[model samples]
Target: MGRPRLGITSITLVKTLFLAALDAGAVYFAVVLAWQGSWGFLSFLLLGAGGVNFLLLSHKAYPLRYLFPGLFFLLLMVVVPVGYNIYLSFTNYSTGHILTKEEVIRVLTSREYAPTPPVRFPFYAFGTPEELYGVVLWPEAGPLLLWPDGRLASLEGHQVSDTDADGIPDVLDGRPRLSGRELLAHYGMLQALRVPWENGWLRLATLREFGYFLPQFLYDPEQDMLVDQRTGIQYRAGESGFYSPDG
Candidate 1:
């Protein structure tokens, strides 16, 4: 009888130590969650930890001895969703939901616009494959140099002349202009070139035409509204994850 009592005491001691270790791990997890500002998850963890310690350590709670099943179900109910939510917080979960407020502002402001009765110009491609340039020929405004930076300038003595009368200028600022064959070799890239114009962009519409385009929506941070550049319609950000004029 004495030996049996001693064995029982040793088993109880081991069980107490194991329960203490488990509770310590739970407390550590709760502290981490608190530090992360996840108050909701931290609350759930604390509750679960407290319940587990009480169930395992209390001698009067003999009927609650089968605590593993309850603990497993509690973990499923609490941990799974909290883990999934944490995963989503790091991802671009959806279209508008993906980016932060500052990122969205930067993206929206990058769009450009060309005013009504658009400023169109006849342009010619010039330069080597390493550096391509544009010269805009405004019928009444004379020739304006279109640099890659979107700057349109008229140089005092740098007038371009079509000496060969091929409708394309032969020389611009003493640099030989790219011929048909040379231009054709890099036609794909040259066609996609865009330069800044006023408050919008000047895009290569064709080999001869440059078109101006403007931003469709402009965000006003002060009023928290998206103003349509075309119609002047204002759309407020809605709680339903979209912008609407009605809101």
Candidate 2:
């Protein structure tokens, strides 16, 4: 055909090396995002994939050198972070160790609140699939109320009492249901609802107050400690994952 292509194997080897570099770079940035909990991890991953696509299609476009800058960026952002995390995994990087113990302890002792009883309400969800917008509630005890906007009214001919505070009467008489943002707002109403669903009411319970509950672990920078709300215990990094009452 065209002077019989020569050095084809060498060209293939160069292409392989470039692709491998891109893959390695992508993996690196992905790990970095995970470690740092950085916001742009997804962005870096996308960039890496884009780089691979660019390299693959470089020959099809004019001025192939234009793609080199992008390839360089992918290597720096993705490959470096991945390699760093791999290095971290080999050492005592977990709890009681230098780098991660504090965060581990903080998570073990976060505070949590139990929603009060009478929690269950006949509920529905709404919004444009992207964001949860709002909710409306009819209690089984108090009133047929649309919440969030606090729009309240009595459903015509339907009586709200101890049995059916949630205004959708036991008898369905063709009432148009709440939708859109109104449904999204229902979650808050679900939490705020004082009605008992089965047996438990939502209450703020920590080992410090209620003996039978647990806390969500969150970091307390000032105290320099991890508080376990479940067991009513606090663990310090120096204590090596052990929390004693006296300590």
Give the per-residue Cα lDDT of candidate 1 at 110. 73
Question: For candidate 1, lDDT tens digit of each residue in 189-219?
Answer: 6456676556777777666677778887788
TM-scores, each model vs. reference: 0.51, 0.30
Question: Which stretches of candidate 2 lie above 4 Å from their native place?
Answer: 1-90, 93-102, 105-133, 138-166, 169-175, 178-223, 237-242, 245-247
lDDT of 2 by residue, 92-176 (tens): 6643456366456554543454443413344333233344332323344653433334343444554333235653333223233
Clashing pairs in 1: 112-214, 112-215, 113-213, 113-214, 113-215, 114-213, 114-214
- The per-residue C-alpha lDDT of model 2 at residue 205 equals 27
